[model samples]
Target: MTQTPPTVAEAIRDAALRLAETSDTARLDAEVLMAHARGVTRSELLLRHMRDPAPKGFAALVARRAASEPVAYITGTQEFFGLPFAVGPGVLIPRGDSETLVEAALAAAPQARRVLDCGTGSGALLLAVLANRPQAQGLGIDRSPAALAMAAANARALGLDARAAMRLADWHAPGWSAGLGRFDLVLANPPYVEDAAELAPSVRAYEPAGALFSGPEGLDDYRVLVPQIAGLLEPGGTALVEIGHRQAGAVCAIGAAAGLSCVVHRDLGGRDRVVAFSVTNELAA
Candidate 1:
């Protein structure tokens, strides 16, 4: 005899319980995965859970979670800076901490006519900044073609493609920085996780390591990025960067060494997460 499938309520509860056992995301992971499989929102799924059965696909999603895949990877999208962007294995998932970087960018870019986002990832920062500055045009640069494609899709989805462009160029690649030219604003949330060996299992085991750590101290990206940015920004232009909480002091010094007057910005958690700076000489002029 065939067994009966569980109702949506039963499935969600079971998934939540199982996910809670293996991941810190817990109930949220369960809800997001179930909603993705059912082609519904988390709230919509919960509202009808009592009346609905777990779709077959949703059961499979639960199985995947049991094996430890990130729910955002399963859902193919994530919300960041009040916007939804496409995401999956190749692209780094957007994180709320990065919003501090976006907010800093917007505040500094109020009068920006041209902006640039380095290491665009899923294009989260670039798109979020463009949404706030209708008069500003922006370019997003990434080393990965796949990442650029996702960024472009996000821009088009938000009806901001006319003002945003994407390109594939490694920040460390020779001649890459020179070709991009000057901008009134620059933003980057480069990898700054200092202790890769001590990362949470959910992160070290699942998220892309290349997107999480840079150099031994996790300060290599900043070291390479700040000096290049100094020459790239137009006079008086600002740059916003996301850095690790503990490494804010070192990151700021690197920016200062590169000629930027830096100020570290803290996240809602009161941890230093972003740093904003501009060329001191220009401001002094």
Candidate 2:
């Protein structure tokens, strides 16, 4: 027997009301959940209410939202820089603020021919850049094979498979830059949260720790990665890295010590979230 769906207005109101108790993203989450339930886009849902009964399966998802699971994770996808990206448990969800990193990268090398995205999570930055520059080629590297697989899948979905490839590599390891030619640009959003203890409950408890923490100070990855990979950047090449809001000073200091001049960039909220740098000296193998 088929079940009858609640009215569209009723579903939205209920979801918003329930999610409001635990989530900061109440209205948006409600709209997304109801849209998913009716098998329609949010826009489509707004245009037409569900004509059938809500399935038990749909109600369960609503419960999941009430439990404080991120709507993006529940939906298994998110939009980054206007493109859809698949996201799940192991990989970090693409975030709007991270797009500020992408903007800085694109602004630095609008015509860059070859780029590298280190620790490419859901491949959000790499995919977003490729979408804007169809002629460019990129390589996305991640230490976790699971993250690499997610990145590769996103590449295929975004039709960037031909232009972008994913690989498993730790940016801090020795001889990691040997095979690839020097790149015109590097984009990375490495873990920069200094106080993991202070991260939101959802982040500290739900997100992968590997993708969120970088030692006690949060500068371990940059200290080891920037110097080794600076040789991988061609002269005149640029690197755009996302940094912790409070760690910009340390990030710039590290970049300068590594023979690069770093500049900080801010997100919409005016918090410093990205650092851009350029190699200042020629390097030998």
Candidate 3:
């Protein structure tokens, strides 16, 4: 005799338990994956399909998650600043804490018309800012072609392609910003994780290392990029750079040394998450 298939709720319940060993948000992950498999939003899954039969191939998705794959990667999408962005293996997944950087940038330069996003991975930062501040046009530079591809795709998907451009460039490259005109605002979420820092299995095993670790103390990127930021910004332009929670002092010092004044912005958790910078005489509020 054939066995009955699990209900959507039952499948998620079992998958959540299995994912618990590997993920902090196991239930949420299960629900998200279930929604993906069913081709519905999580809200739709809960409201309209909880009692529905388990989606075909959902067990495979759960298995992947239980083995530690990121839910965003599994679903090929991640949300940033209330916008959906296309993301995959080679691109860095946008983080919620990084939204603080977006908020700080807009707060400092509400009418910014020209924006630059250094190390734009999925174009989420530049695009989100431009989406909210409609007058702005943005240029996103990244060294990785794969990342640039995703950024470009995200731009097109969000109907910001005409206002957002993705370029292949590196922060460390000499004369990289020569043709790139000064911008009214700049944003960066550089790799600031220490080389030896411990990370969860999912991050260490799946995320791209080139986008995760900066140096022994994770100050290498800031050292090279802050001065560049100083050159990129217009006279009164502001920049918001994301930082690891404990990195406020170090990152702020780097900004200061580059002749840009700094202010620390804390995430909702009250952790130092972004450092806003501006030319010394024109510090961002």
How would you encode candidate 1's per-residue C-alpha lDDT over 1-285 as one tens digit per residue? 998888777887888888777777777787888788788888888787646777888778877877777777878889998899988777889999889988888777789999999989888999999999999999999888888999999999999999999988887877897667789999988888775459766567778777788977999888888878778889888889888889889988987777789888999999999888788974436
TM-score ranking, high to low: 3, 1, 2
What are the runs in model 3 whose C-alpha is more than 4 Å off?
A: 282-285
- State each model's CA lDDT, in order: 0.84, 0.84, 0.91
Give the best candidate by lDDT: 3
TM-score of each: 0.94, 0.93, 0.97
The per-prediction CA RMSD against the true structure, in angstroms, equals 1.8, 2.4, 1.9
Instruction: Count clashes in each candidate, considering only residues at least 3 apart in sequence or on different chains.
Output: 0, 5, 0
lDDT of 2 by residue, 1-285 (tens): 875557667677777888788888788888888777667888887766655454446667878877767778888889999999998888998889998998888888988999899999999999999999887999999998888998999999888999998888987777777798888889998887664458766677778888888888999888887775577788788888888888899888988888888889999999999998887754422
Enumerate residue pairs that collide in model 1.
none
Model 1 residue-pair collision total: 0
> What does candidate 1 score on TM?
0.94
Off by over 4 Å in 2: 1-5, 50-55, 281-285
Best by the TM-score measure: 3
Error of 2 at 64 (Å): 1.2
